[model samples]
Target: MKFCYKNGILDWRIVVLVFLLYLLHALTVKILVVASIIAICESGILLFLALKRRLDLYLYTLVIILATTFEFPMFVDESLKFVPSIIMLPLISGYFFLLLSLWPLPKMLGNGSIWKTISKKFPFLFSFVSITLVLGIVMGVLSLFTDSTSKTFHFSFFVKDLMILGVFNVYALYFMYSSLIYPQFKQKLELIIFSVLVAMILAALFVSLVGAKGFYGTNEIMLMPLSFFFSTTIVFFLFYKKYSNNHFVLLIFLSCITFFMQFAYSNALGGKSWLVFFLILMTCLIFWYKRAKLKLILGSIVVFLLFPFLLNIVEKKTDGDSLSSSKLVQALSLVSVVDVDWYTNLPLSPKIRIEELLNTNLEFVKHPSFALFGKGFGGGHQDYRYAYGGYNPAAFSLEEYNNEYFIRMHESVNTIFLKFGLLGLVLSGTLLFRHCLVCNKSPWLVLGCLWFVFFWGYSSSLMSIGLSSLFIGIEDVRDK
Candidate 1:
């Protein structure tokens, strides 16, 4: 815990350790099953530590990070083109260990004295968890009457979806309860954040040098953490004056590191990331030079015109084709409704995803009762319609397409609605909102909550146990 130097960057020893850990991740991740097995072993160790009352946040977080970095493949058959990756074991098992270390939920639910203690000690968390139990019941009831087709309904999907839906609550519960047991909670929380930052940055570094499977084995994995780095850096810079250890030099280094991430990732994405990242940088500028409103307006104008040009270029390193040339205009039009859904530019995926969301929403409006309770776990919706833009529709059957889309649950918020319904959405959002409000003084958590809202529109990692501790560690800090 002791750093030789005083600046905000993690100490040299910690950085070295992170790099060493990243190396372990690199070696184990290629087979993916290797990483998965190691993760399972680590989980056993974690459970033992927890039972022995020896586990701490840092150790738990480190193991969880390693386990989560890669997808575990149980079957890889190229001849049949069958490769199935195991998701829930890595995602759910760590949490059982996590929650056990924090508090025993089974006992707490029935214990009158325990409930009284929790209620008096942390009223908001107490209320949040109590409501969460009701939500859990609704989740269970809706799951029982699941509308999932046989093609998509599996026990893993059922459990995985449940976790994704409740990801926020799980972490919030950990954050609130973990506070009672852990001392110097704020410093420990900072370490957890730094731990994630270092882990991902080192992962990105490993990918660049060694040409390995991207962090945790996914090629595009670095993107989120990189985006996160810039985001948290923005918040950190906003409060650069608050923490005695925070340094401007460290801020510059972080900005540059995030820029590298953007550059590295741009080659892989279609276009939306550029727009989002552009906004992130603009926000960074506004905060960086807080007093320059006139300059900010002018800078915005410049970025608005030129940023797309830059994006178009990045989309294609050298493109003279007319359709490719109009990408600038496409980027602009996409931005107009970009906030509607994260689906943008890509022809079939975006169009179908948006259409599916609208269709699912209409289904809810059409059936009030369905909206009240939801389709439950392992739920799937009617494809409603499809628009295969560039690809030949004749090549793929409608049933295949429907099945493919149904299982994805990519439009994350709608996935919540489909499985859990409007009631679930309200309960889930309220739990998150209350937890995010843990410390109004922290703009970081407020902005983070907003980011997740945007994220829910696109991806399905909503329930995955990622960075919940970081949020808890900071947001749960009482105002001094």
Candidate 2:
């Protein structure tokens, strides 16, 4: 059967007929019910394709498996939101596939040719400063013309969009410059060292003199530098040559250690669990690191041992009570669903949640008519809230859902799905899959792709202003 398909001896009509039968049933049945049948079929197809040397089809099959895994868990309980997982898994998978399809096979995958092509057309340094200055001026003028509180001009929204666009452009330019102009290992090394030093100094200053009041109370300008620094460091270390290997490993390790120490001290002194999450992620990455053998094993072991302790520390720090201890006991007691009425009573984080709702609602409203074709270039509303939070004003409310796990909730996932629909989902998924495919052959590109994938979920609209800047920056770097 596989041989017949590979050789084109089997009639294509037969395959189409089979697919139609399955798809018809899929649409008619409950999604989970249909998905189970499709999953089995897809698995068989994947196995067949793998044996037949149909690499592309095999990969697509792998994507289907991954997508299904992510989606299926959500369907087990309607109350347990699964839409986000379903939407994201396929979207990312399709993206990776699309990216792979665009590139020349295997060897040329991460050669930086794509970046070079764009950079050759536009000079990096001139483009960077010029774009930044223009955006900054436009934003400044717009800010002056409209009242921040006024609904008419929506100055806050416009300014936010401009800022997002500016940041995206800046990131793109930086990556381009780094890849193309910073040719030597020494240049990359120097840049990383400088960035880390600057970030450390700023962090120390913020921690010591500025204090929490100053840190959170300000207009977030100080925070911007730190965020930029950390994000850049993440990008740089992921792609940089000298520090890309064992040095990067050491840096991550030390960083995790530092975070753990901070968590410990915070528990003793009263701090936050947000930092603990960051630390856990860092620790997890150490094990996920592809190169170092011993570090991965050791890191895994350490994480396992420290897991309970870390939970206790986090719980204590977060609620300022024995809540963590009780939760631990409940978890150990195999209490599957622990009811907490306090959740329903608690108010939502208005600032963040409201913005998120607005962005999602906007996308949902715009989606029906504009389903096939996306809002063409700068056609999207330039609301600051949407730019930052991916919220749609049309769909959600300021009223808190009270679920701390809203990140994985259906509401959150459905927002993007509503924006893009099936077509958008496929396109986005293809792009991500393609990225993975290309990067698989090119280690450097793999690192870059990983960085992008990791953050894609945390932000709104993967293909918007941010990606534009990122792609352009990467292109610039590759060309020089």
Task: Point out the worst 10-residue segment of candidate 1 by lDDT.
Answer: 74-83
**TM-score of each predicted structure versus truth:** 0.71, 0.38
Clashes of each: 3, 41
Tens-place lDDT per residue, model 1, 67-152, is 23433221111122111112224445534533543444554446566556556665654564455445544654564455444533
- For each candidate, the alpha-carbon lDDT, in order, equals 0.47, 0.35
Evaluate residue 38 in candidate 2 and report its C-alpha lDDT on the 0 to 100 scale: 53
- On lDDT, the leading prediction is 1
**Mind giving the per-residue lDDT tens digits that candidate 2 earns over 1-480?**
121231211223333433343233223223544544554465456556645754433432332233113232211222322222222222342233223222223422355665565446444333433333353444335333432233333333333433333333443443343344333422322222233323333333333333321112111112111112122233333344544453566456545543443322222111112323433456446546755666676767786566556555645565624332333332322222243643332223323334454554564464444434322211232233423333432222122122111212122223223223344345445545655554323333433343343333223222222233334333424444
lDDT accuracy of residue 310 in candidate 1: 62
Clashing pairs in 1: 69-216, 142-376, 164-463
Model 2 Cα displacement at 69 (Å)? 42
